[model samples]
Target: MDADFLLIRKMKQGEDKAFDLFVHKYYKEILTYCNYHCPNKEYAEDLTQETFVRFFAKLSDFHYRGKTKNYLYTISGNLCRDFYKKVKEIPVEAMELTEKTEPMEHQMTDVVNKLTLEWALKQLPDEFHEVLILYYFQELKLKEIADALKISLPLVKYRLKQARKQLERLLGEEEIYESGSKTCEL
Candidate 1:
């Protein structure tokens, strides 16, 4: 039995608390995605609100066809696009993206490495950046990414492949592949 199916059944049965549970589960992830896309924390909060509002409004159409996370992200991604279109006049590229200050415990090398990586990601086109962030940072499955992007599975694979190649080029070196482990480490 799929736990997501059970949750959807409970939600369909008019369990008002189910929506709250769902929000609590996905709120942070949705917000993080919004912040990354919009690069403004307060506006991202509003986008997150729009995401949940749309989800609840469309609740009657909900089904267990895919993981709820996939559904939520699809909604969030669409909202992000809509928000951008609405605010198309504003040049978000000119607005500086403020990085939340992290604790100074890390060594200088680690900080530089992180900064370099962020720079590299920013240098990529939006499509490459989106695929890399969804696959690596958010830890979403390729299928989930396909569903969220509303793209075919094979296209998702191709995008991921292209993103990896671009990242290697941007990083100036390729990570050493660990055979059988499915991971590449520097």
Candidate 2:
């Protein structure tokens, strides 16, 4: 197991390898999460870099009271929040459609619906978005997500329910059509 505790210990002792290991483990996830939340790739990339920089600067102060991933994610989330505050004057509507769409398994008609769900996720309140992403994409259990987001399990369930309802409202019949139909293996 990649013990984040060990990594943090090495990091606190100023080991370069530990820092490299941390980046290797988290860079993709951090970038993906930030990109999903931010308006543009440039902003996402900047936030990702800033998150790591802040993480490194604060490594010595880390108390290891929780999973390193959760702690790191909390830091990343805070950086994203700060960025959002700075860019608050920019219209949210203007931020939409900045991401380029590529060919998906579903056609354009369905792509809009899929993107609608994703965009709605991005638009969700941070707590709901964090819980949903941690639970679904990260595949963490409710308890794990609650620990990660520092919320209670009941609150995690409630947020997940709200997120699902919102997503269903955005996806609607498209979800049924895609899921109810059988898939043929090539």
Candidate 3:
């Protein structure tokens, strides 16, 4: 039997410890996903809580057809979409850049690259941005992302390809603006 199946079984039997274990296992990941969608930390926290709440509420109906974590992501993604509809905000939290001992000049370059990537991601449509976040930031497999987002596998591939192209264009534009010279070779 799958571990998640056992966990769900225990949870369904009203075992508080099982529920706690489930929450502890996935809370940080879900919160990180929500943070990518929502700029406000507080709101992201709320969305994370709500994702668990909805999952627990539907626990009885949830069959272990896929990974539990993916389901949580789906719930959080829906909640984030609803949040965007109400708030009309496009703010996104940037993924953390790697920390390493480097010279000041290299550090500054890393910061600029991070900012430029963040800006480019924000410029992408929600569909494209979500795929990039799931694939790159959250490190989800392509099939996992398709299952989580309830999208077709081919569609996911298409979106990822298009998103990369768009990001390249956006980042190229930023480089030109910053350096006052075209740096990207088309």
- Best candidate according to lDDT: 3
Q: Compute each candidate's TM-score over C-alphas.
A: 0.69, 0.75, 0.77
- Model 1 C-alpha lDDT versus the unseen true structure: 0.73
Model 3: worst 10 consecutive residues (lDDT sum): 177-186
lDDT of 3 by residue, 18-87 (tens): 9999999999999988977776668889999999999999999999884789889989999998997898
**Which residue ranges in model 1 land beyond 4 Å of their true spot?**
88-126, 167-186
Q: Give per-residue CA lDDT, model 2, range 74-107, as digits (tens).
A: 7878888888788765544545452346555445
Candidate 2 regions off by >4 Å?
89-111, 174-186
Quantify all predictions' global Cα lDDT against the true fold: 0.73, 0.72, 0.82
Sorted on lDDT, best first, the list reads 3, 1, 2
Candidate 3 Cα outliers beyond 4 Å, as residue runs: 90-116, 173-186
Best by TM-score: 3
Across residues 34-149, which tens digit of lDDT does each residue of candidate 1 receive? Answer: 76666556777898989888887887887678567877777877887788678754444544444547555554455466557656766777777777667765667788888777
Among all windows of 10 consecutive residues in model 2, the one with the lowest summed lDDT is 177-186
Clashes of each: 0, 0, 0
Clashing pairs in 1: none
